[model samples]
Target: MLMERYMRVSQAYDKQVYTEDGIYLGKVEEALIQDNSRIYGWQVRLENPKIKEALRGKGIIVPHTLVRAIGDIMIIARVSIKKEE
Candidate 1:
């Protein structure tokens, strides 16, 4: 699904998604938007301690371009930091 379609249905504090080799990462604390209009990505809150231990933080931003799918939940193409650089 397109990010714009997701923006129409989803809201803040909704679950954000993460994946690496098809594994789930965590849920979202907030959804980020572009120009205050469509969703640009999200602010994901890490749930697993293993992930927390790895990230050394509570949350991170994800971009809409990285989104692979949106079904029962939001799906990201890969697991990563907020930005590339």
Candidate 2:
């Protein structure tokens, strides 16, 4: 819950994440913590079909620093998604 404001970790999960430009990215799957004190990043399930297929069904990790705000919905910086051949 270190994104802009703070909240319970439980409240963090299942939050729909979006890019700053308002593109729906995914939902918060897991929060990456460090040493048990700090959160480093978030593991987000790929909801966008194109991104999901490009990621091979894997999730994306958004760094904590990129997070702008968090509440009912989480806002973060735009992430780069490259579809591999």
Once superposed on the true structure, which residue ranges of model 2 sit more than 4 Å away at CA?
Answer: 1-5, 80-85
Quick one: RMSD of model 1?
A: 4.2
For candidate 2, give the lDDT of residue 39: 94
TM-score of each: 0.70, 0.81
Estimate the TM-score for candidate 1.
0.70
Q: For every candidate structure, what is the RMSD over all alpha carbons to the true structure, in angstroms?
A: 4.2, 4.4
What residue pairs clash in candidate 1, if any at all? 16-28
Query: Candidate 2 on 1-85: residue-level lDDT in tens?
Result: 4555557887999999898899887899999899999998888887888778757966888888888889899898776433223
In model 1, which runs have C-alpha deviations exceeding 4 angstroms? 1-12, 83-85
